[model samples]
Target: MGNGGAKFKFLSFSGKFRVLHLTWLAFFVSFLVWFNHAPLLLVIQEQLALNDQQVKTLLILNVALTIPARILVGMLVDSYGPRLIYSILLLITGGLCFFFSLATSFEALALARFLLGFAGAGFVIGIRMISEWFPARQLGLAEGIYKGLGNIGSAMAAVSLPVLALWFGGDDGWRYATGITGIIAIVYAGIYYIGVRDTPAGSTYFKPNKSGGLEVTSKLDFVLYLLINIPMYGALALLAWKVEQLELISFNVLLGIWAALVLLYLFQCRKIYSVNTDVFQGAVNRLQRYKFKQVMILSLAYAATFGSELAVVSMLPMFFKTTFAVPVALAGVLGACFAAVDMASCPSGGWISDRFGRKRSLAVLLAGAALGFALLSTITSEWPIAIAVAAMMGSSFFLGSAAGCVFAMVPLIRRSLTGQIAGIVGAYGNIGAVMFLTVFSFVETSTFFMVIGATIAVAAAAAMLLDEPADTMIEVLPDGTVQSVAMH
Candidate 1:
């Protein structure tokens, strides 16, 4: 059999299967740590005597640092390798979690939670890790499983943390719930470092020519890459504005953060040009060059898909409780369907891309997600509660599948820069969430759903702009010989 036709043996204890299991477990724990406070936030708030605004600030801070951290982590993953980066991230995240559990003041809790956002960067690491172990033909399914199964960590956090807090049954019970996740992460960090390899034996691990930022193929792409970076920093600026508006930080502090972000953006642009400076010199070969628009388009797609998923899942329980007059527990269960459905939807989305086509599959799923959200916009008290939930579940399936389809294409875009590309895409997902949630602050629930639908429609158009993956991509082997890896 050709190397491209790799069949994943899920039951196997060795080879790529072992790598897949290990990497996804690492990702799961990262997410588990990342969202550990979410379910127990109420208890944490009560114990700490936090007001509503302070609670909101914690949520914002949780994701605020993650946007920029993903970009930095992406570069690190490409420059180093997933095995090392993942271990270090876990160790750092564990320490932050421990710090958070010991917090007495709001300042300490906020700082720890903000820094813990780095754990979310673990997802991009697995994208690079799995892409290394799996061949092109199986890339989508493998990545889908990594992303999908790992996402279950968020749900697990929601379900287990609260229960653990109750079981511990005290004012500081939430701390124990949060702290235990740290111990688990620290233990597993060592296991992952010991067990995982960057790549299988004899396979060359590819690195970017320049590690500062992404390398673009054309002048237009360079311009586009710079323009695309605005939203990432802009989202952070928006967070600062929100916190300032809340009076959580001094106005001058907010201004300083804004200034710092501007300087960082300029520095990043300088790095981008420096890294890809040789592109204009005709130093890059045509066969090895990949379009940067592919990155931009996929980033937008992820912003709408996974980004919308993040926004919706955050608000779904409250939406269900108020609209349907359901009990909180029932609403929680109903809302969870959006995330719970990822198990099948993500893999199915990837498998469809593998079987049929990537661009077409994403476009179809995005369009379906649009329809799902559009349907959600019209639901009201007059609508049957069951039917409304079913619509939400249906939309979730589309959105989840579209998210899977986005990753399906991420690995194929440029293999060596898969981590960086995943970083950009993943950051956009967070950007989308921040924007959607910000919009949710003013808009009604139904309107929020409609806005997401509109976003997905635009992303569908962008998906059409993507050039389908060619049958083969050229990669350099360790001995300097080139090989054409199968794309399908």
Candidate 2:
């Protein structure tokens, strides 16, 4: 890590940087394809002659599958490896894009968009991939670069898709714009599959000993795992409520969804039992006893950090427009500053965690984020627009940093289960989004900020329970001998 004297060359394609660039590009394209319809939503609305509620349904469906998809993909990536999973997902993304583009009815579009949430799972896969390639010392920085730079794809989609549509011209221009993203996915999936490796040659790619659910070390952890999973299902239930209220789906379907979520929750409990049943019989070794509460803590922290990011990013444009009484276009530009700052600030957060300490960095960042959001709550019509924008940017710095810093701790906990850990933590982000947005629907903009601000403060308090990562963690190599990796 002291190799700062030798500038870390990003252009080198030989080692970790190659994997970082390739994987981030994969994440980048996934986000772009996932959000491709967003920029073109207006055109689609006009073409399909859809009502406002239906358009909102499309937005809801865009993220509906992601919470569960990340969990499923995490298991698959840990089992099969990211190279295969990512390539497969990208190919499917291509097909979904094509399907959405050719939709002749709202059902087809909604179906395509819902299925396209699978693309969001790509982020989890690349997290596993990057963690596999980079050591803990460089992990935060590497992940920050991957995610922060990758997140730009959404902004790029916003900026470029509309222009692409205009350039293509005619009513079908949106279709072509959407289809081009699909084509990119199809082509890149091939390249990624052919080029990427699960791990550096001769290095064992560790897999969890049991496959169905995350392995927990103790009975209490088992209970903690089950308790934590409740919110994910609740998030799905909330989504069903939103869609049902819009009359996008029948009440019978909503009932069926609730039943299915209950069944899935029970099934997950069984899986948690099936995987960690030995914990009830025997004591786990201290070397192996990574805290399940760590996951719980990180989940809450992520819900505050990334969850708030998703909710706030979605709301910022409207919030700014309404509060400032500015042009919609100008508000959009201002809103975009949140994401624009992410490229630098996210890396800064990770760097701060790496240099200072993960627990301290996250705690400070979360507290800062809470304060930033609290300040945002104080913003009023009487306030100058520039002052308000500065407060928003200040929050973004903390929010972006907290997002990057969260993953900085993930790889060091346990190498084999990083994907699953990442998955659950990532799922909470979506859960947080659903929860925050659901509450936002019932409250004012200022109330929304206060709610998030309070939630983050609560998460920060919980974060105090997080123990710093130890000097080393043990992972079983493919040869069955445990290998020790440095944590700090």
Candidate 3:
């Protein structure tokens, strides 16, 4: 396989580029609907008369289910193919958005927002879709472009939703604006279904050998995979603890939730073992194995990068309003500056990974992200607001790029398992958000930024241990024929 290709023409909406455009737009709609309430959160709080604790709980609930949803969606996309799975996901997200927009009580709103977390899993679908359409040499840039443009949905909500609420000219204007996102999601679901195929003509879309859990090649990896799953459930437990702290749930209820989480973990371990029973029996071949360590390192990196992005973006508009005493609309625009840079920076990270090497690009970008967050931590109310915004945009550049770098390697790990691998990595991103947001609930804004910087710095060091992906991966056809897929 060659490491060169024709220059990408992103504007041309023909061939694979057409799939790229449509697929990314689907992801964009998912994010837009997922976060429509964020910039307008204060408005919702005022209209519904929510307390501070309830407001913070909304942020936690927004990302809590995404951890498990990504894992489940990953398995489904791998089994059914991205085309069908993504369409169904968007349709479901649209309904959830409508439900959220019509919420008449905090309980209803909380339930809607928690259900909306599934939309975040839409990202995993596109990772597999893009990997099918684009080759490895261009995979990084392609994935970067997909995620970069798609992620603009959150920034768009930040910048537009506030203005949109004002335009609608009523206390319920926020509802109208949010409902519009739902309509867009539903309309696009049909368009995405018709506009894209799972793979190009005459190409095969590979499926995992088994379903329910990610397959591991070795016994040690099986154990590591099980151990790695603990944090996901632990993150859920953390959320339950936070709810208990809010006094919404009793201590006894919290204990029950924790107990259920333990049982869930044990059940998942059983499914994982069933999926990779061959590993225990010593029947898996060497060439068929990929390192589970790659998944672990990428998961950690994503938790810091994308995870921080989720936590920060969710809270940033409010952060600016309170810290610098800016108006809501202006604060939203400033908060958007954090995610706006994704358009350029994400692709830049992917291009860097493509031109250089994946391991090197991720490590360097993560290091830069740590430094960026460190600079952000120094911001105080005394500082000029413009400087704070500059520091935030600078930090976002590194964070978004690091996210691009993380997904760039996900598909290359195992072609057939791309969706599940992307799911695990993507789930960790939410896990990071849950952990960081939980921290934010307890600490001051500066402390929150400082904690993220420290976590990301540690992930940067671990990135060095990542082994570069090999030139090819072997997969089995349904007919039992062995096919060697080229990575580059």
Best by lDDT: 3
Cα lDDT of model 1 by residue, 1-488, tens digit: 01334566777768788888999999999999999999888888889999999999999899988898888899999889999999999998998988999999999999998999899889999999988888766878888998899998888898899899889988888999999999989999999999989988877777776778887877788899999999999999999999999998899999999999999999999989998887778757788778888999999999998888898888998988998899999998998888888778998898888877899999999999999999999999889888987888889899989999999888888777888999999999999999999999999998998999999999999999999988787865546677776654
In candidate 2, position 422 carries an lDDT of 91
Going through the candidates in the order shown, the clash numbers are 0, 0, 0
Task: Give the clashing pairs for model 2.
Answer: none
Best-fitting candidate, scored by TM-score: 2
Candidate 2, residue 301: the lDDT equals 93
Residue 25 error, candidate 3, Å: 0.4
Model 2 Cα shift for residue 62 (angstroms)? 0.7
Q: Clashing pairs in model 3? A: none
Shift in Å, residue 347, candidate 3? 1.0
What's the distance in Å from true for residue 66, model 1?
1.0
Q: What ranking of all candidate models by TM-score puts the best one first?
A: 2, 1, 3
